[model samples]
Target: MPGEITRFVLKISLILAVFGASAPVLAEDMLVIAHRGASGERPEHTLAAYELAIDQGADYVEPDLVVTKDLVLVARHENELSDTTDVGSREEFADRRRSKTIDGRLVSGWFAEDFTLAELRTLRAKERLPGIRPANTRYDGLYQVPTFAEIVQLVRAKEAETGRTIGLYPELKHPTFLLQDAGIDSVDLLVTALREAGLDGADAAVFVQCFEVGPLRRLDRLVDVKLVQLVNTNDGPADEPAMRYGDMVSPSGLAEIADYADAVGVNMNLLFGPEGIPSGLASDAQEAGLAVHAWTLRKENAYLPPVLRRGTAENGTGDVLGMVTILEAQGIDGVFTDDPGLVVSALAQ
Candidate 1:
């Protein structure tokens, strides 16, 4: 009987050697990332929005970073400030408006690159989706655009204050556009700021993300923090020389991405099939040793999958919890949502 017990132990040891002792515990808890800092409740990319998101129990808060004329890294969804700020109504800055081609499209607006950081401070944030969330309109024009350094400082202070680790997920928006139009390297500015704050290492509570592969590849070399390569389903314009986001989901493409990125941020549709069930994309990414974080899970019906949407009204409610459950089952590592409170509550259950 002793010999039999010894043999059993040997077998267990061999199995553990082959599979690794912690293999069974490798599964990560699904994270709730505040898409632009509980953006459903407050104007995005503002200090108030980020503070509100921390209060609501988000694991991370995302700030899409754009550069100003003076090379200051600021948080804004896009360099164009027409939609998310009151810049359009500012008569003093009306001359700043100009039509320029960005990302293969001609857009007329007050670009962030055209304004100095001090000039930008004169503008205030507004509700980007006031039609769906009219209540947010009341808080519009109350908050100022926050700098990347300011956001990092806020998160660090919050961590010390709350005793809970809060992470920052900042995306390099329109990298190609910034390079071509403004002749500024967004990644360099971002890395410099992070390094100054002592948040440039692999263990730092930060994730630098970008849609364009060029910037992310460059960032991978510049910073030690984790990087996420965002994947979109849309094809690039014919004249655009960049690779289409659709191609990045292929097995070979994912393997290539794993070479530089720690994770892949995909559109929710990439994870679903024609039947609206979870697809093999998540598993494929897992096979490539890449974490998957899906994006933009909003409460409004228009933003949800057809089957999950509740009422006919565009702004009506939807089965956000149901959608989240499906993604969790698909082995998603994190979810980006405008309503972080709802996602946090759903995950707890």
Candidate 2:
């Protein structure tokens, strides 16, 4: 840990040397959160991915949580498993496949809730987007779908090994659908797990996030740990249609959100308008006394803005440092990235 502390101190000094004394605060406060644990390099939501992210200097690792039939919390981008697991190839679990409507869209797949943790252990994690991240497909059958508790254990072990305090950013996926349609209370399960792990205290390095308002509002009443309201550019929270996401970034909307949320995790595009002018979202949300974190800074050309992209190949790397620089200038509190190593490098520059 002493080495890590020394590295951090050097990093701070380097920031000041390169960008001036005023730059230290922004460099230190802005967090580089691993979106699904350096997902650009490994199958997302697996222990290997999370560990890689931590080793690459990420301040936090994010896990999108879904439940099993036994109500155990596990990390997956969605409740459906076919895209990210070998469940579809397993003959024993073939009958488990079916169609269900989540958030008004009908999706057919092998769902996690249909199997117990033991049943899920037999399936191996795989790249969710093989067409875009074909390199990650090589490790397809190597890792297991990790549980929320298991992830906490991994973080603790890594902290002991690295001597650095790593944070957990867990997002309760489809909270409204999971509770109302699937008949599972993910919030209680998450809180109970955090409580058992001694991570529910106000000082704990945890931020509970949700895309729906009801769950975040409920969590605000249930836990002292920070809560984040995730907003995308296109739509509103599924539970609150009248509350448009576009409007949520407005001064009036941000004021309303500040009542229940400590931070707003928004789409990165929201921070900029047409012609790349500052959209004022970061400033507006901060003005409402709310921290603003931007989502998904990836190196792939497909994910980068046109000006920063290198070529037509969607899978090729782009100028991610330029993207990070733009967001940093907006005074964003944090950034979610698929490549923690790249973001860490960008911030160091």
Candidate 3:
């Protein structure tokens, strides 16, 4: 009970520090997306982490979607299970381990594609970054890998409970690999799932994001929901090997992307220059009629620039408030973060 009280006090203090009030409400214009839920605090892609993000006032919860052997969609950063699950320790499934080339890279592990949803349910979730987020390991082995359908149900329930219209940001992980290499039609699976959930329309509070260009273009025709084209700093989309991501963020590239995608979800580095000056990429994309959302704003020192890091410890929280402030000043529409409450706090200030 004393520990509980301490936690409650900390929570309220955090809220008050940013919002200057007891309630944790967010502004509607600038979006706070929970990258794999509050992954900084809990295991990524678990229902527990997602619920925590929603409770912390995240507008959207991101679930990187991968398919099971039964063709059901589940939330995982990648199809590989060993990193985020206890599949490696499960003696019963030891034989299931094998190597396969996914998206042109050879990966060896227990894959979601090899397991039916029932088989996956038998495994438990663990912190993917146990080295950096040691505290999150207390939650390790406590959650099951959640289905996208289950996530939708959780969101709908939360919306009703909170009276806030929460949004779903689902990324199709390795769509090209699922299609060409694994022989699964992920686009159809996703479209069918969203349609069944009544979230396939333009008015739906959802964004279908992908790193590949071809799938987003295909989705644009099939679904009315907004599409986000994810761009990396150095690498291009796997499906479009010859096309550089650098070109995609250019004026011409932004124009081309605006043709199909509603927004560009770019790596956070693209938004800032050497001394954290605003790069014109956000404004440039917006000028091309695209909303700009940035990927992966984390509080940890490991993920932050050396200037922003708070301590020598890699796991220590950094100047995320300052990072979000910079991105907000650049006028980006939304931010993806592992620590949603921190971002919410930053934006609320």
Candidate 4:
């Protein structure tokens, strides 16, 4: 029996060696992160959007979080609620519609911070880009603004039901604005929620992302889960100037980022040239031992580069699969897409 077992082990080892030497370098499995839940099909940040994303085989679901007056953390792309909700039409919030300088931009709107969780709950979500995504507008007024806790619960339930591990990617939107304007510690609230969900450990399938270095640095000290520093292609927001995102992709900038963040989520433009080919940014981040995840892959021709656009309409279809294929070839660790199914299918190819 011992002699027979030894012969079998040798045979398997020989086969592996033969195949391994001839095989091309295998690529890491590219992750498909549903940007704001399958946001292309539903009102972004709503539970319906998230659920659709999960159904489409997303590995992670992203929620851009903002704070409410009662200090509840809720899913919102920005604190300004006018564009993404039905606040403007509601006479009850008419008096609440006032402009204030937030993060250096003077804006007038019914802000989320002015409403308690219950008040915010009474409102319904709308399509943020109705003109560009008329189909998604069909889902408007169908879902409520989900709280961070509720989002966590939904993801947990999905995981248990589907028997598949899905990650949570929550961005702390405008941390400085929240801290200065409302005296709210957004990171603390996020960390508390993550801990309560039993997802604050180092190995937990959670990524806390922020655009500012200061907030990311603070979060690194508070949470054991992975932290991602988001970089905009343009110079930092006008009201809040910091290091340019271009600089952040530089060797030294990435090195500094590696000190606090396990990964970098950059504007997709940084990974491509005007001719639509791979650039050095992904390789540089990998060299610095930081995982790279690119953002905002939409099907609209307007959102895509000139080289990849398929039509002239603002809402016209583009070669999303072609762009995704190029990005995958660049060896990115993950991608953020409004259409999670497209990315999943492209990656499978």
Candidate 4: list runs displaced more than 4 Å.
Answer: 1-27, 237-242
Q: Give lDDT per model, in order.
A: 0.85, 0.88, 0.88, 0.85
**Candidate 1 total steric clashes:** 0
Please give, for residues 144-165, the per-residue lDDT of candidate 3 as tens digits. Answer: 9999999999999999999999
**Shift in Å, residue 74, candidate 4:** 0.4
Write the residue-wise lDDT of candidate 2 on 1-349 in tens digits: 3344345345544654665434423434689999999999999999999999999999999999999999999999999999999999999998999999988789999998889999999999999989889999999999999999899999999999999999999999887888887799998999899999999888999998888999989888888999999999887888997888998889999999999999999998887655555666887898899998999898999998777777799999988777776677667899999999999998887
Worst 10 residues of 4 by lDDT: 18-27
Report clash pairs, candidate 4. none
Better of 2 and 4 by TM-score: 2
lDDT of 4 by residue, 1-349 (tens): 3344345334434553565522112248888899999999999999999999999999999999999999999999999998899989999889998888876779999888899999999999999998999998888888999999998899989999999999999999888887888898888889888888899999999998988888888888988899998988776733238557788889998998999999999899887666443457888898899999999899889898766676689899887766666666567888899999887876676
Candidate 1 lDDT, 237-287, residue by residue in tens = 232366776777888989999999999999898887665544578888988
Query: Considering lDDT, which of the candidate structures 2 and 4 is the better prediction for this target?
Result: 2
lDDT of 1 at 318: 81
| Per-model TM against the reference | 0.90, 0.92, 0.91, 0.90
Badly placed stretches (over 4 Å) of model 2 are: 1-28
